[model samples]
Target: MRKAMIVWGGWPGHDPDLCASMIRGWLKAEGFEVRIETTTAAFADPAIFDLSLIIPIYTMSKIEKAEALNLCAAVSSGVGLAGHHGGMCDAFRDSVDYQFLCGGQWVAHPGNIIDYRVDLTRPDDPIMKGLKSFEHRSEQYYMHVDPANEVLATTTFTGEHAPWIEGVVMPVVWKKRYGTGRVFYSSLGHRAYELDVPEIRTLMTRGMLWAARE
Candidate 1:
């Protein structure tokens, strides 16, 4: 079985613990030998780089230089990385290396917890296969993303909440490579329950599997 690890803990608003549990259950069902940790110290383990995949759910937290370097080295060496929302992209804000590895960083969420539509940008991609555009009533993330990301889904700002960005399109889902490793991220899932939406759930699970590089 493929080996995977989920390290979660940080901002309570994001419910990192609950979200980690959900991801752990899903990964187990997918035949992975999954381990769960509630500390960033897990990233310091030299063996972390040996795992098939790593999911970091801690948001707005600090990562030591050693931990950050370990993670970056692991991903660059072909260990896959996957995460959603602020948990991944918004994590370790002080570490530019981490943000670079993620291919994006959460900048702001205008009109927090508002109704929005997610458009499928690359329906032909396996990670987005059979998925259609869907509606979501949650924070529509405005992120600073890497130009090289292979974007798969997007959303347009209505300007109702933030007029300056009216009709501006932002990437909602994207996949990119950190060296030989596959990196997947979705701006959805501001809260655990938001993942209950079928399309959101499917997209995340598939993205995880794809990132595992199995």
Candidate 2:
């Protein structure tokens, strides 16, 4: 069985525990030997490098130097990493290395919790195959993303909330490589219940499986 670790804990607003539980169920159902840890210290373990995938659901938290370095090294060595929303993108705000690995960082969410559309950009990609544009009533993330990312889905700003960004298209889902490792992220799921949306749930699950190098 493939080995995977989900290290969660940071802001309680994202409901890290609930997110981890949902992911745990998915990973186990897919035949992975999954472990869940509530601390960033788990990233420092040498064994982390041996895992198939790492999911960090930590938002706006601090990561020690050693732990950050170890986590980066593991992903660089081809251990896949996958996550979503502020938990992954906004995590370790001071750690540029982590942000570099993630390919993006959450900067702002215009209109906070409101309805928006997530348009599929690469429907042919396996991770996005069979998925269609969907409507979501949540935070519309405006991120500073790495140009190198292979964007798979996007959202356009209507300017209703933020005038300057009106009509601007922003990436909502993307995948990239950090060294030989696969990295996948989505700017969705501000609330745990959002994962219940069929399309959102399917996309996240498929993205994690893809990042696992499966």
Candidate 3:
């Protein structure tokens, strides 16, 4: 069976545990041998680094250097990495190594929790194949994105407080190639309910499958 391990915990504000459980259930239904290791020690062992994918949902903490290096090597060797919002972008704000691996950092979000629209850009992408434009009432992330990342979804600043920021499109969802490893990240998921959204769930499912070193 396909095997995967997710290391999650930290910053309950992001609800990492709850989000991890949801992703676990989806992967389980998809026939993967899923495991959860909610400990910092797990991130450092080389033995645990050979899974089809490695998911880190922690935010703003230093993982053991050994473990962090192992994960970086795994991704460079073609293991896929996937996460959303702070789980990936806000994870290690001070660690350039972490930012390099994640492709970008979360900068400023104008409307933290305002009505926003996520426009599907990569219509041909498998993750967006059946998706139409989606709308949600949540924090619309405005990231200083990596030019290397291929954006799949985006939102424009149409709010009154965003005029100056207008025309500066923000990426809502993106996919990129890191060395031999594939990476996927979405600016959604500020809350558990965001993950519960059918559109978000669908996007994440396809993204996970695509990023799993297939």
Best by lDDT, which number?
2
TM-score of 3: 0.94
lDDT of 1 by residue, 19-96 (tens): 989999999999999999988889889998789999999999999989999999999999999999999999999999
Instruction: Kindly list the per-residue Cα lDDT of model 3 for residues 148-169, writing each as its tens digit.
Output: 9989999888856677887767
Report the error of model 3 at residue 32, Å.
1.0
Where model 2 places Cα greater than 4 Å from the true spot, the runs are: none
Encode model 2's per-residue lDDT on 21-42: one tens digit a residue: 9999999999999999999999
Poorest lDDT segment (10 consecutive residues) of candidate 1: 192-201
Q: If both were scored by lDDT, which would come out higher, candidate 2 or candidate 3?
A: 2
Each candidate: RMSD to true structure?
0.8, 0.7, 1.5
Candidate 1 residue-wise lDDT at 77: 90
Candidate 1 at residue 106, lDDT? 92
For each of the candidates, give the backbone clash count: 0, 0, 2
Question: Which residue pairs show collisions in model 1?
Answer: none
Number of clashes found in candidate 2: 0
Error of 3 at 141 (Å): 1.0
